[model samples]
Target: MLLLFIPIGIMVHLAEQLGKMQDNEAPFNEIMVYLGNFSITIGNILLPIFLFLSVIFFTSKLASNTEIVAILSSGISYNRFLRPYLIGATFVAVFMFFMGMFIVPNASIGFNEFQFKYLKKGRQDRVTENIFNQLNERDFIYVSRFDPVRQIGYNFTMEHFDENNVMEYKLSAANIRWVPSDTLYRLTSYVKRSIKGEKEIVETKRRLDTIFPFQINDLTPVSYIAETKNLFELNTFIEDQKRKGASNINSYILVKYKRWSLPITAFILTLIAVAVSAQKRRGGMGVNLAFGILVAFIYIFFDRVFGTLAEQSGFSPLLAVIVPNLLFGFLAFYLLKQAKR
Candidate 1:
């Protein structure tokens, strides 16, 4: 565990330096502060998994070396030997779950802010493909592409509907910009047409300013766009979108569920580790280590696959987040049963 963290520390330092180079700015002390906080946050997030692996690796070696057999011959059941491991894993799992759900989210705000200032370097200030935002209770906006440098949107469309679910007005524009001074967004080089009672009124405008309830921060950034929000922020964002009547919220919902599920992976993997390596095999420590790594890789792969599906499909995010744990829990149970026999 001590050695594992050394590489993480090195990576954080390298990331900070890389940020400074990109922005042409001196390395700020604040960056180090954020890095330290972020590292701790990440460590907490991964601690359960580490604890699980540590328990399995050490205990498995003891069992392979005949220590477990000696203990079993002394009239102790294998389940009795698991008390310490389960206690430790439980503690770590609870810690990781709480930290991931409550603590890391807020810390990420600072972490991301530091990265944006020193590393991202105005890259996020611009908007790009598939921009979506909620305007009001009955209004929403979607744009195919936006160029912040030019303050123009390509294929911009705003939809407004009445309380009765009837289409009230729809506006399309080739380009749009925010007139900061007056707190208005101006659509330019565009045609404005409104439909009412099977009649359409079409007009051409050089510029039109309208009041909209969107801030720069309200726009999503391309990086860390998924699952970077804290519990409060995520809840608030969801409520805001719901109020604005936005349809798709599957991604955000998945992120919320994953915060709790990820920590439990540690405990489940630990059980699997102990079950896999408990038997005295001639292949020795090398074999146990290889098996451990393979299992870990498989677990990570399943996590990524489910995460991708949750975001893309209309599947329940809660189900997607918990499915890996559920599947592995069954595996662990099966292994434990086999080892006992």
Candidate 2:
């Protein structure tokens, strides 16, 4: 793990430095901060890859030395020989799960902050456009555009409904700005129309102070908001975003489901490594390593393809997360069956 991790980390660090150097104004403190964040992010991303390589490398060595053959020749079942590898994989999966669920989310927060603060200075937070969603059981809201930095929205409209789904009142504003000091909203050119059975009551004001069920935070969310939240926090966030009819809700759901799915990948990869490298090959460890890399690349390709489908095309997020695992799981079983023969 250290051997692979160190070189990968150094390469990433150097790439970041080269990019920053092109700007010719890389601050020493900023670079230092980025280095710390880069290391953690790299470690988290590469942990499973390193574990897969380690299993294949060592197991191939054992097969080459006839150790596996010796054990099998003693009448011990193939399944029995796999116990230790399974146990080790289980331990690795647990550690990875904990990191993915708790530790890495916080690290991602810092890593993304550093990137936005220094690397992506001009990019704006993701502000919802054409925002139309249910504010609650009794209210629905719409806005044409929202300025995240200003905590304001333009061309805002809201509707209040009765229990029978009858429109009771409608509110319109040329602009709405959050007043943080008062914890309320100020609407400019506000207009309200109330319907009372067969009568209509209209009110107009140049400016109005009021409160709503939603807040400015709901108007603009960072792109990596899902990445920086733990499992429970992610669940709560997804629910809140869903209520707001967020277009990027699938992205958040993808992240939440992937937290559990990624850990299971360790076990699946371990099985494939053991199965593929258990037999003595004429080309030795090189052949095993090459095959392992090919399988890993394909697995990653599937994961990215399906995840993109979920994020952009409204595919099922849960299935997007599990499809790669399912494909590789079948590959593992097939390889194991051939290895036993």
Candidate 3:
């Protein structure tokens, strides 16, 4: 696995470097940093593929050499023969689950940060443009533009409503800048209007410093914010974003659900690989390998297609993660039955 992946990874990285070097866009130091980050992130994603192929490659060799035949001839059931494969798959599954739940989030954050800073200078945080989102049960906010790098917003408005959904007060500002030193916002050209039944009282200020319920993060959420958070943090973030009426909440939810699904996929791939390679064939290990590669690519294709559908459309996130697994699991079962026969 390492033999195959390391060369491919390095070649791809070097190709990227060649392009960036010709343009003089990235420094050698940044290239090194990116190489490290890219390798780790890519490795995590590729682990299941490597494991699946490993099972097929070794198991095919065993079958070709008649080792599996010898073991099964001793009156051992195919399910019994599956015990060691299950054990190996369980080990890989647990490791992958833990990595996705904890380790990969940090790596992803760093990798994306480096990419945005050096490789993708034009990248902007995906905070909703001209956002009009619920701040709370009785409050809402609107911002025409939020500059994530500057931590500032232009044309900000906050409205507080009564239980009857009537506006109680409305605050408007030409600009709002985060005062990190004091942990408040400095609102320029601020105006507040309070509605008391039929009367309205107005207050105006050239500049006002005040604290609002919303934080800087609420204004400028990067698209990959969900990828940076661990499982617990991601759940908390999703809940908070849901409360805020975040537009990209579905994508966040998808990321959270996929952590579990991908690990389960590892197990399913193992099953399919073992089932496909367990029977000795005249075509030998090469045919089994080719078949395994085809199945692996098909699995990835289904995963990406369903995942994109869930992200772009109104499809269920849970179902997006589960559908590919279910389809391939049925394939695994059928193949295993045939192998047993």
The residue ranges of model 2 lying beyond 4 angstroms of the native Cα positions read 21-30
Per-residue lDDT of 67-142 in model 1, one digit per residue for the tens?
9889888999889977776787777778777778677777776777676666666666334778887677677788
| Residue 251 lDDT (model 1) | 69
The window of 10 residues in a row where model 1 has the poorest summed lDDT is 217-226
Candidate 3 residue lDDT tens string, 1-341: 95689669879878765665446567778767767777778888888899999999999989988999999999998889999899988888999888898988988887888777766667675764697678789998889988887888899999999999999999999989999999999999999999998999999999999998778767758888999899899999899889988777788998988888877888888989998998888999999999988988998899899999998999998899889999998998888888889
Q: Report the Cα lDDT for candidate 2.
A: 0.86
Indicate which candidate wins on TM-score: 3
User: What's the TM-score of every candidate structure?
Assistant: 0.77, 0.92, 0.94
TM-score-wise, the better of 2 and 3 is: 3
Residue pairs in candidate 2 whose N, alpha carbon or C atoms collide under 3 angstroms: none
Q: What are the per-model C-alpha RMSD values against the true structure?
A: 4.0, 2.2, 1.8
